[model samples]
Target: MAVFQAVRANQEESMRTLGQVKPWCAGILVGTVLAAGSLVPSSGFAQESVSVRAALVKGALPADDPSASAWNSTPASEFPMSPQVHWPNRIQEVTVKSVKVRALHDGQQIAVLLEYEDPSQDPDDAAGLEFMVGDKKAHFAHGQPMAQVQGGPVNIWYWKNKDNNALDMNAQGFGSLKVQDQQDVKAKGVYQNGTWKVVFSRALSTPDVEHDTQIKPGDFINIAFAIWDGKKLESGDLKEKGSQKAVSSWWYFRADPPPDYSAYYYVALAVGLAAGFQFVIIRKLKKGATS
Candidate 1:
């Protein structure tokens, strides 16, 4: 009879100990499973990409307004700029160290806002957006040499502070810049408090497909930039002199696609599975403790 009592006491203690550990075990299992689920490539668990995203908006985009309230809704992608040293008339000094870029799309048109600091608002100040074409692989400086035009061509949307609109241009090499016959790019710029704000806007697709880098929604494209500070006498038209400018390397630009809710469903499924697994494990532990 004494031996029986001892065995009963031992079983009771074991059950109590298991009861104390049950919750902790279940919590650990659930935590680990959920952490793994979060890593799944679902929209709910997706991280931001390294490209400049043009967010789609319901209302009209602020085409030429740098201070428009519509622009406040989008996030900015800041890129560092360096002196253009690949070609002749290279920038000896870097005046513009960085540029803050924001983009918006209204399904039909897109607008890009570029803001940078400049101590003086020089009349010769100009900004440009350049993208690759043809082979889509060439020197980012502008393009390959004219003799090697078959290598690739580049489309440029050049905007000057003195002009009411941006110029549609193209180039194959350093001194091979030419204005396009079709002008579809529009731009406006404002300077205040030692800062310059410029906005460039155009239709998502243009008829001049030969010379324009046609932009499409939900597409990834390579792009570069240049800024000519008039105070420094940087010139885009005169390749022989004053060609020094701040430039950027190739970067990606993408228009955000429509929302996908399938990821939410997957996340919900994963959470359900984790809860079910925890319940099963706890049930087995409880059964063992009781027995």
Candidate 2:
């Protein structure tokens, strides 16, 4: 009888220990899964795994237009910056780690609003905007100065706030930069509340212009962005060290179709109809009762 009692007590203790260990084991497993997920490379921006979508809006999109207020309702994708390619081994401490981009397009026009933080708002030679547009998709390091993919042809729209209100031109290959005698690109920049909001807009298609890349609706294109924080003294390869100093460089962004809101409209219409019917039924019941 004594031996049996001791055995039963041991069994109960063992069961209690197991119950405590089970929770710890589960917690460990959850922690391991979360740690592994964090190790994966992601910009933590909205819809980064999938292509970034642009929302289509009505009417003409002017570069200087306050229409970007509409983009506030659109989803934004975050773009991260890394060091330029010239110095591969050195990790750069970039001020602009991420840029928030929202795009809007009418069938005939497309515009992108780039919002980033810069305390200085350097209007001097320090601040500039670089836009790379490609019709076809290909993989290549966009960090290289004048970088180009073997099969992909990219058209560049370069803008400097200190310069004329036009965009400088460049192509994929080296020595392809051509500053136009006249500017076809429309750009308007505003620095307010320690953030620079710049809008770049153009027609969907521009033919017979070597510098301009023709764009169309429902077309899949590759876009990349670079920003020079003048306060950081970021310019391209100025020191001859083969490094383009910039606060940030975001490359390899794929453009998705504009957001479609048709389903929401239909839903609203259905709800409105249901409410009207309910109201009419209530009124009819009240009239019958009074009569």
Candidate 3:
């Protein structure tokens, strides 16, 4: 397209100028260009899609630590949190406006870090990740009705600030949350500087295949989120349950497969060849002027 060609021309001009200024600048530009090119959609066309990308790493992922250095390289996706207005016990006022999410995977396991601003440190506060099941559509808040769970059941990974561990739970519509027998989810939360950072981690696959969502590399999964601010008197009581928290609509989540560097190699080679050709042309032009 004309747009792509123009963008490529601009990039080439920038790179040539930088290459003449300093060799190190050209190297940095190469890296920057490569990163930008990698972000283009595989379809060769761009469209709007909201999803949390889990970067694939080589070794172990940072499980419980929210301040781990590995997270620095991982890109963050922030989703707005809104009051739950669907249920009777819904939150009319929003205490937590938004949450920043970052994720990483080590091929075998995946870890997600959630960061939010909260003035009061309520260890009683709770947060969790909810996943949809199958291709069938269900209520994003809870899930399908209990009797119709066969159509689709929601899997939840819940963690309370006061608890030392996370709970693997399931739900089918309202008032149907049940803790699973297999407690495979692990979490850790820390409060500092008027903010709460929590990290949750679990294996890619579990034995409870029927109830649990199997996460695979390069697969798009539907995910939702919920957070309860205990400072606002949100609790687990049936009378005050339902929607007394903040929730998000269904969003996509994907664990990226390992990256391929062959494109980078080819691009770098082309740039080098282009630079050599430009140098030869400039030298010949200068020689002609002198003669």
In order, candidate lDDTs are 0.80, 0.56, 0.79
lDDT of 3 by residue, 163-236 (tens): 85699988877788899988888999888898888899999888778778778889988888888776644464
lDDT of 1 by residue, 117-146 (tens): 987876678899888765457567778654
Q: What are the per-model numbers of colliding residue pairs?
A: 0, 2, 0
lDDT of 1: 0.80
TM-score: the better of candidates 1 and 2: 1
Name the best candidate (by TM-score).
1
Candidate 2 to truth, TM: 0.57
- What shift in Å separates residue 155 of candidate 2 from its native position after superposition? 1.7
Off by over 4 Å in 1: 1-50, 145-150, 232-242, 276-291
Please state every model's RMSD to the true fold in angstroms.
Answer: 7.6, 14.9, 11.1
Model 2: per-residue Cα lDDT over 50-142, one tens digit each: 344566767755557534567686777777765555345343654555677777777666677777776766544223344444444322233
**Which 10-residue window of candidate 3 scores lowest in summed lDDT?**
232-241
Query: By TM-score, how accurate is candidate 3?
Result: 0.69
Pairs of residues at least 3 apart in sequence or in different chains that clash in candidate 2: 54-258, 126-230
